[model samples]
Target: MSLLVEMRGIEKRFPGVHALRSVRFDLKPGEVHALMGENGAGKSTLMKILSGNYQRDGGEIFFEGKPVAPDSPRAATDLGIGIIHQELSLMNDLTAAQNVFIGREPRKSFGRLDEPALNRQTADIFSSMNLKLDPKAQVDTLTIAKQQMVEIAKALSYKSRVLIMDEPTAALNDAEIAELFVIIRKLRSEGVGIIYISHKMDEIKRIADRVTVMRDGEYVDTVDAESTPLSRIISMMVGREVSEKPLDVPDTRGNEVALEVRNLKRGREIRDVSFTVRRGEILGFAGLMGAGRTEVARAVFGADPRDDGEILVHGKPVSIHSPSDAVRSGIGYLSEDRKRFGLATGMNVRANIALASLDRFTSKAGVLDERGMRETANNYIDQLGIRTPSDTQEVRLLSGGNQQKVVVAKWLLRDCDILFFDEPTRGIDVGAKSEIYKLLEELAAQGRAIIVISSELPEVMRLSHRIAVMCEGRLTGILPGGAETTQEQIMELATQRESAMAPVGEVA
Candidate 1:
């Protein structure tokens, strides 16, 4: 196999960080190379260089055995390279066909709009990838899975010989993942080299031909995916031994219920989803993406309007029409999309920490007590081990893990007894994930009711005193916490969407 792409001695630098250093990466024809790294490990930085999103400070890139430098994303695309970003980039109102051919559209003889030609071309690409989606369907109308398919279609339309997918299946379900794998295999057979970046070990094992591990912006080693064990791969990525510790669920058999939901319904996503969390207990919500887990959390936290439902906190029924009402009722929700929904990126650490409980740091004259806010922020910074130069540093400047801690501090300061963590560790590194898990355990130990919504089966199995699985828009079943409950059992319940017609609190 000949090398299709080569990056030698790649180096990238920011104001205070040497993002990448002396990194070497290569891709061969007809191979799926997996990139493994911890968060902030420079995998993305290296990819950005390849896709022409960032210029390397020092590096030599060779394409097809010839030295070449791409100055921009367009230049890379013109050279048969296409990259699908970690974040979905699509116009919500535009149709799938339009998004697929946004910059490069087919024109008629007179340069008039050629709607039929565009749809037909997109339909052909969809057929080639074994995908079922109407090209005329609006992007917002499609599920996350279908939107991902559109991105893939758009990449293929560029006549790309080398394709890059960054965490493509992070939000996809098992069925959708299988469909994606089929398309990947088809592309593999066509001799298109693929660069797959993901954190899921099972995915890399199943799809990748070779695995390249990086740590702190430097290449560690490359190993054969088939022969290498998952433990070994993880060890290489983190440069340390990793443990698979099962979560410790504390006793709460007779504890009072902190939160109760009855007959909750919101659109078609959540239907009569009812559950209760005991004080000092960690209740895990387990399901695939789009399984109504987050929907239930949003409804409970009053982030979304509910068509019909009843919420009871501490045995007292409360009407929560908005997030302010939920917060006043001692409930807080940490959204899965931390950057978008949880944090005010433009604000400093102290301001973000004080956001939820501004009254505590406000004077009677409506003036902010900067001294009190700074003191509280500093306390949280020390207690939570938030990595920052000072309390006034911008929240966006911190890592994902530290930013998450800020959110946790916010809810803690607000005196929220019942907390909802939706995909709490998504986009965080492995080490940071353990820290967050420990923090959740500590919060539960302190008698705070915690509801954890996670798509990762291992996380659900490792953290919950009891597990609730949802499919489509209904709670399927709840399992007692222990080593006895396996990932397979939870997945079985997660895929049971047909049985969702039954009302909540009913055993399937």
Candidate 2:
């Protein structure tokens, strides 16, 4: 049978970035091909070329054994290629149905939008996918997970022969992901070619028939998904055999308390939470969903109104009534939802990096130092290993992992004394994750107090010098972090009640 899609020696270049070089990929008629790579690996760039969003500098593309060049996104769509991008690209003010059918929305006799037909068609698509979402719901009102599903539905609406999904499951929960897998299986049965891009190894094992790994800007190898060991694939993507090692925590017992929370209260969401994070430490916040780990972060950062609490920085009480105040007090927060809170997606990398410390880049006369800002951004881009053509690239153009790095750079540039990283590595690849881990440790070594909230116990165990577990909006326990601190201990603490708090550790 002829290959559904094939690319040979795919070469692409930006102004200062050689994104893809001799990259090769092929999709079968009815198989899930998983594309695995770290940030800046050119996975998205290659796919974008396929989807006709960008013109390939050099490559040979064969669709059904016929050589053809797709010049634009519409051209690719006409050829039955649909892509759900890594980032959400929906019109906020439009209805779910409107966003799904966007430019090609159904029209009536008078050239009016056929709202009823649109809603009905969208509803049918959602129903077929077992997605119980209202088609009339506003795009801005929907949750991130739901918005992601809409993106999926929009792609599926194209009835494409080839479907490319980039991190489709990044924003989805376990149940939503399972539903998506079912949909994938159905499409595979229908002889549709599926190109799945994600950093999640487990998903590759579960849904992919073949796995292709990319590193830097080159193709490594493609192998049977079930047969190959994940470690081998990871090694190919990272150019090293990554191993799981226990965290080595230095003794921070004598360090001065950098931030202290005394009886932090925010109604029932946060109940008298008391904890102290010291300078030169990585304090891990571990808890299950709805356990108030993020709530504490929000309350402390002044994003959420706290009914009562005493916040102390460097052993002195500080008044923090807003996020601006928190920043003024030398605190930086990296939210879990980077798209909504951490970044201005439409802005350039240099502008976003200089967002937090604008004063540092401006003269007293209010003149913006463009050259100085550019230099500072470039320095951090190199230092943080942020993948971009240049500092002038729009943040929305970068991969999810790269965007997360930009958010970190913003805070790092601000030179905050206390940092809050909420779910820092969610949706990021293993290679980028390792870099973020290293950056956190480096910040701690520089005497910056860090609070890292992560649901992954292994990650918590790996990065923390001390672990604080939360349960039902309260601090349940604080354990010493190391190889000796097991996931079982953290799990127990995560489910414990406030009334049953252990006396082994002093929280304040």
- Once fitted onto the true fold, the runs of candidate 2 whose alpha carbons sit more than 4 angstroms away are 107-115, 267-269, 337-354, 368-409, 492-508
Which ten-residue region of model 2 has the weakest summed lDDT? 499-508
Error of 1 at 252 (Å): 1.2
Give per-residue CA lDDT, model 1, range 1-508, as digits (tens).
6799999999899887888889998999889999988877899889988998999999899988999888899999999999998789999999999999996788988988799999999999999898989999999999888999999999999999999999998778788898889999999999999999988888988999999999978999999999999889888878888785766667797889999999899988997778889899999999877788888988888888999989999999999988999999999999989989999999999999999999888889999999999999999999988888899898986878899999999999999999999999987867778789889999999999999998888888889899998988888888877786888888778888674444434221
Write down the TM-score for model 1: 0.93
Clashing pairs in 2: none
Question: Model 1: runs farther than 4 Å from truth?
Answer: 364-367, 495-508
**Candidate 1 minimal-lDDT segment of 10 residues:** 499-508
Candidate 2, residue 287: how far the Cα is off, in Å: 3.1
Q: Per-residue lDDT of 379-434 in model 2, one digit per residue for the tens?
A: 99999889888999999878777898899899888878899999999878898788
lDDT agreement with native, every candidate: 0.89, 0.89
* Clash number for each model: 0, 0
